[model samples]
Target: MKKIVAFSLLVYCISCSPGPEKNKDKKAERKKEIQRIAVKKDSLQRDTIEFVSYNDDFDYSQLNGKKGKEEISYINDQNNDRSFLRGDLIAIEYKNDSIYIAGDGETPQNAEWIVSAKKIKDGKVSKFRKEYNLPIKYHYSKEGEISSTYLDHLYKLAEYYIANSKKDLIKISLKNKEQLGYSVEKQKKNEKDYYVLGIYVEFEHRVSPFQWLYIDPETDTIYEYDLPNDKLIEFP
Candidate 1:
C-alpha cells in the first residue's frame, strides 16, 4: 500500500509540470506583445512630430564660380539643420544612415546643412528649395506669334510650382490631364504687363482656377495671386 501511494504521487507531479511545447508557446506570445507595444509607441511619436526644411540664411554666391567639389564653408543654422538657400538645388543621396551631396564627377560628401525637423509638414521641404531658374525670353507677342519655347517655359514653371505646393493633390488628380493643367495669359499688374499662368482643374466639364502665378519674362521673378488680400505676393 505504501509503494502504490508513492507511485501515484510521482505521476501527479509529473503531469502538473508544463511541457517544452507549452513553454515555447508562452515565449512566442510574449514576443508578439512586445512588438505590439513598440509599434504603438512609434505611431504616437510620428503623430506628434514631423521633419521639414528651411533656409540656411547664408550667402552662397561665393561658391558660385567655385566648381567641381570645391570645399566650401558657411555658418550652420543651429535651430534648423535641414537648411538650404535659393538656387542650391544640388543632387542628394542617402546611404549608410547618412545623407550625401554629390557634385559633378566628384565624390559624395556628408551634407551638414541637412538636418532633422519636428512640427513641420513633409512637403515644406521641397517648397523651401527654389528649383527653377527661368530663362530670359521675349514677353512681347503679336496675335498668333507667340514662340513655342516661351510657352514651353511657362508651362514648365507652372508645373514646378504645382509639384512643390500641390504634391498630394496632383498624385490623385494626375490621371486626368484636364484635372491638372495650366494656361498662359497676358495680364497687367501695377501698371506693368506680365505673363501669368493660370493653374486650373476641370471637374465634370467645369473649369475652376486654383492658382494664379505671374512671371516676369525678362527677370524670371514669380508672383502668387493673393485672392483674399487682392494683391500679388512674391512666391518662394
Candidate 2:
C-alpha cells in the first residue's frame, strides 16, 4: 500500500510540472509580445502629425451686384511711388445699410495699408477713416459682398519679409517639379486671436522630408517649420 501511494503522488507531480517545450513556447510568446510593443512605440514616434490640405473657400462673384467706386491713388505713399494705383479697390460690402469699400495702399511696410472707404452710404464721402492699417479678416460669402485673391494676397504678404534678414532665411531646397499649397488656420495666444496661413511644400523626390511656412495674416508674422530637424520658431 505504501509503494502504491508513493507511485501515484509521483505521477501527479510529473503531470503538474511544466516541461521544457512548454517553457520554450511561453518564452517565445513573451518575446513576441515585447516586439509588438516596441514596434507600436516606434510607429507612434514616427507619426507625430499628419498633414492635410485645405479647400479654397472664397467666392469672387459676390461683388457683382455692388457698384465699383472710382479708382484713386494710394494714400500714405510716403515715397511718392504710385504702385497702389495698379490694384483696384478689392471689394464693396453692404451690411446693416452701410457700405464698406476695401482697398490696398502702396506703402509696403511691416503692415500693408488699408483705406476704409469714407462713404458709409451710397454716393457720398465721409472721410472718417483714412489710411487705416486694420488687419483684414474678411470672409467671402456667396450672398454677402467680398472680393479677394488667394495668390495675390499671399504674394503681397510675402513682400513684407526681409530678404537679407537672418531670421528670414528658410534653407529648404525644393525640387523643380515640387509645388506648394497653403491653408489658413485660426489660433489664439495670450487671449488674442490670430489668423495663421500655413504653406506646405511637397518633397517626394528626396527622402520625403517635410517643411512648412507659417504666416500670420493679422500681424504679418512669418515662421518656418523644419520637421526633420524638429525645429520650431518660438514667437512672442
Candidate 3:
C-alpha cells in the first residue's frame, strides 16, 4: 500500500510540473498578444482624428512675389521655424501621423509652399516645417490647352509689387472692380508688343489708401495705376 501511494504521488508531481519548452512557448504567445492589443489601440486612436481634403480655393497666383516674404521671415526668426502667412489661402489635409498645409508664395516663380505639422497632441501642433517649394510651370495639358495668360499676367504683377513695396507686408489680388479686370488690349513700348495686367494692393493699415498695380508683361515692369489720371505711373 505504501509503495502504491508513493507511485501515485510521483505521477501527480510530473503532471503538475510544466516543462521548460512549454513555459517558454506560453511566454512568447503572451508577448505576441500584448503587442497585438497595443497595435489595435493605436489604430483606434488614429481613426478618431478626422481627415481633411485638399482645398482648391487657395489660388497660387495670388502669392506670386515677395508680398509675404517679410512676414514669413519674421515668423521664422521669432520661432526658429516657419509657418503660413496671415493672408495665405491655405489648404489642409491629414494623414496617419501628420497634418499638411499648402499655400502659394508671393514670388515670381509662383512657388507653392507646404507645411507639415507633426507630433500632434490634444488638437495642437507640436512641430512643423516648410517642406515643399513647387514652382508653377506653364505646359499644355492632355487636352492641348495652355494655362490662362490673364492669370500669368496677374502673378507677375503681384511679384512686382512685393519687390517694390516699402511696407513690411502686403496683400495682392486681381482688382474686384469689373472695370479693372484683365484686358488684352495692345500695349506697345519701344516697338515691342505688351499686355496690361492690373491688380489691387491692400496695405496692412486700414488708414492707407487702396492701391492698384499695373504690369507690363513684355518688359517685365510694373507701375502704379493713377486712378484720377487714368494712366500707369512708374513704380518705385
Model 3 stretches with alpha carbons more than 4 Å out: 1-150, 167-194, 201-210
How does residue 91 of candidate 1 score in lDDT? Answer: 35
Worst 10 residues of 2 by lDDT: 43-52
Residue-level lDDT tens digits of model 1 in 71-140: 3332233333334322233432111111223342222323223122232332432442333222212233
Model 1 misplaced regions, further than 4 Å: 1-144, 166-178
- Candidate 2, residues 1-236, lDDT tens digits: the string is 99999999999999999999999999999778655543331111111111111112321111111223431222222222222211222332121111123452221222112222222232111111122122222222344222356445554443222111244212232212234334455555446554444444444532222334455555455665555765446331
Clashing pairs in 1: 81-115, 82-115
TM-score of 1: 0.39
- Please report, in order, the local distance difference test score of every candidate based on alpha carbons: 0.49, 0.35, 0.37
Regions more than 4 Å wrong, model 2: 1-151, 158-177, 203-214, 224-236
Between 1 and 2, whose TM-score is larger? 1
- Candidates ranked by lDDT: 1, 3, 2
Tens digit per residue, CA lDDT, model 3, 49-129? 211112223332111212333222101111222233323333322122221225422112212233222223311111111
Among all windows of ten consecutive residues in candidate 1, which has the lowest summed lDDT? Answer: 41-50
TM-scores vs. true structure, each candidate: 0.39, 0.27, 0.24
